[model samples]
Target: MIRGVRGATTVAENNDVEIIKATDELVKEMISKNHIAATDVAQVLISVTNDLDAVFPAAALRKIEGWSFVPVMCMQEIPVPNSLRKCIRVMMTVNTSIPQENINHIYLGNAVSLRPDLKAE
Candidate 1:
């Protein structure tokens, strides 16, 4: 079966280094812990707040080992009033034999406070 893993993270600034580092770390952790290999990933969609540029995040994922084959796309999140700033959200679909509850959906850094209900237990 195919299962989806959802996660979101934030960057302290709009700088390229911070964006790349945070995105790489988040994607790496989700795939590694869930035993989801690049070949198994069906698609990876990333949405960044309108405040961010998508190039850095896309480049970050491509730089990672084995991620070259995975299809990735980036989009801008709608600017809702009072929304979080500098946020990067990722939705990934991968072929998995495990149940959804067994998956570890990551929310790290500033994004942790956003989803108090699902913080790492």
Candidate 2:
């Protein structure tokens, strides 16, 4: 069955290094925590707040050997009052036998507070 894993992270700076690091951490955590196999991942969509412009965060994931073929896309998040800045959010579509409740969602950095209901143990 196909399922989606959602993750959100933030960058303290707009530099390329920060962007790549945060994105890499968020993506890797989501994949690892859920024990997601690369072949099971169909597509990944990333969105960044308007405050970011680090030449597309997905470029960094391309450096990972196993993730080379995974289709990735980036988009600009809509600006909303008092919204988080330098935030990168991802929606990954994957084929998994696990039920929805078994999937893990990652919210890192400043995004951790976004979903206090799902706080990690």
Candidate 3:
């Protein structure tokens, strides 16, 4: 069965380095927490707030080894009123035997406020 690993993180600024660094950190933490290897990831869809356009989150993900083969796409998040700012959210499709309930969803940095109910244990 396929499982989805969801995560979100906020970048301090809209720059290539900061966008890449923040995304890399969030992706790493999500993968580690879910025990997912790059080989298991089928694809990743990344959406960033409108204010963030310096770099694509997928580009940052490519900086990780073994991530080159995994299909990744980037889009702009809807700028809803009162929504989180400088936020980049990722939904990763993975080929895994684990059930959906057991999948770990990660929210880091200021993005943590976006999903407080699933706050990491």
Off by over 4 Å in 1: none
| Candidate 2 local distance difference test against the native | 0.89
CA lDDT, every model vs. true structure: 0.86, 0.89, 0.89
RMSD of every candidate to native, in Å, equals 1.4, 1.1, 1.0
Task: Report the C-alpha lDDT of model 1 over 43-74, residue by residue, as the tens digit.
Answer: 99999998887455878789888889889998
> lDDT at 51 for candidate 2?
89
TM-score result, candidate 2:
0.95
Question: How many backbone clashes does every candidate have?
Answer: 0, 0, 0
lDDT of 3 by residue, 45-88 (tens): 99999999998878878888888999999999988999989999
Better of 1 and 3 by TM-score: 3
For model 1 the TM-score comes to 0.92
Model 2: how far residue 114 lies from native, Å = 1.5
lDDT winner, 1 or 3: 3
